[model samples]
Target: MLVINALLRGGIPFIIMGGIALLLNYQEKYSDAKSTFFASLIVFFVGAATVIYNIDHWSLTKQSVVHFLIMLITVYPILLLSGWFTIASVFDALKVFLVFVLVGVILWIVMFILAKVFSW
Candidate 1:
């Protein structure tokens, strides 16, 4: 039941990312099989991590923090190794990290607002 729900949740992003990876490969943007594999894996982690939100007992803050940590640990390395983003210096790495955080916050806010409006 729960497992099936989680699988369904994760499967969408997995398929989407797989397609994107294939497209990138076809276009010769990132032809490395290893990079494609890692890119797909990153999306899997991201999609699966959404299960955290289903934890009703957890506060929103707790859920967001846990999800953020999960993504940072699981997705950051793959993005770097897959040639999605290059960080030639510490400053560049910091800039990338900041941009990641900013995007996450903006997306979170948008989703939160949509959820509230829809629930109302």
Candidate 2:
């Protein structure tokens, strides 16, 4: 199925990245079971969410907007749970949102250029 394929493609990387993040943040204190559980949950949603791209009728902009929103909605909470940031005020949340959006835009541009260059 397309859904399964999408999950496998995106979910695997998502889970892998979770592991990498755990390793990278070695100095931080994270309960192994809790972290693994959260990582699995996050990866499952992220991977499953990628199936939105298969909606051929949707414009690229629409698909992208939906996907970006899904990522932001899903990933941000998990990042917070993982102790990545402590937001004490609305400004903190806005700062994080802006940074996330900025990084997403930069990555999108890079990928667009790479796709054009490779004729993808």
Candidate 3:
């Protein structure tokens, strides 16, 4: 069936990338990985339905919207799996990353002040 083919066309890559990421960096402790994978699955169902219903007809020059949607479907699962597999929960990881950013900014400011004070 055409529908099944289209679903697979988008799904195979999503599953491969998601599965690989899950294997490589997956944390069995936190629920983030499972949640992300499930969310992506939901998105796939919705997106597939939208595609089947002829609702994705947005023009962008020569770029095919269907292809763009397929890419998103393919990429987001991998991204979620990779991004959420850390030991920390996704929220905690974001907070930790933010703290590091702040620390870097503070160091940069201190260096800038010292450079100005030393005229170098």
Candidate 4:
């Protein structure tokens, strides 16, 4: 579903932002839930707009990669800001890496199902 895809693309960064806020005890400084929801909405609109704009101009493969990359680029900063890669232990980074992989897998599965259903 569109909602699922949007969540898949934006959920990690949103979570990271929330985690960082919690870790820094800065929950009051930022409206984490509102900001995350808005970010996800932006991502979803960007994706839908991209698809609509490219409907007659791009292949599915190209669109998929572009969309994925766009989502990744949009979220990478949150990962860094969340201290996801600067943990004191290797296991911590690995845990984050696993979560990233899991997210990717879920995104792929959803996209695959969508593709099949839409015959893309």
Task: Give each model's clash number.
Answer: 0, 0, 0, 0
TM-score of each: 0.76, 0.67, 0.32, 0.44
Clashes counted in candidate 4 amount to 0
Could you tell me the lDDT of residue 81 within candidate 1?
Answer: 61
Q: Residue by residue across 62-83, what tens digits does model 2's lDDT show?
A: 9889989887888766766664
Give per-residue CA lDDT, model 4, range 1-120, as digits (tens): 645655655565656655655644455644564455445444544444344223557777776677667655655434534542676667765666567657766977896788789984
lDDT of each: 0.78, 0.73, 0.52, 0.56
What does candidate 4 score on TM? Answer: 0.44
In angstroms, the error of model 2 at 90 is 1.8
A best-first ranking of the candidates according to their TM-score comes to 1, 2, 4, 3
> What would you estimate as the lDDT of candidate 4?
0.56
Q: lDDT for model 2, please.
A: 0.73
Clashing pairs in 3: none
Q: Is candidate 2 or candidate 4 better by lDDT?
A: 2
Q: For model 3, where is the 10-residue window of minimal lDDT?
A: 53-62
Q: Which sections of candidate 2 miss by over 4 Å?
A: 14-51
Model 4, residue 42: distance off in Å is 7.7
Please estimate how well model 3 matches the true structure, expressed as its whole-model Cα lDDT.
0.52
- The worst-scoring run of ten residues by lDDT in candidate 1 lies at 30-39
Better of 1 and 4 by lDDT: 1
Q: What value does the lDDT take at residue 42 in candidate 1?
A: 70
Distance from true position, residue 11, model 2, in Å?
2.6
Which 10 consecutive positions of candidate 4 have the poorest summed lDDT? 45-54
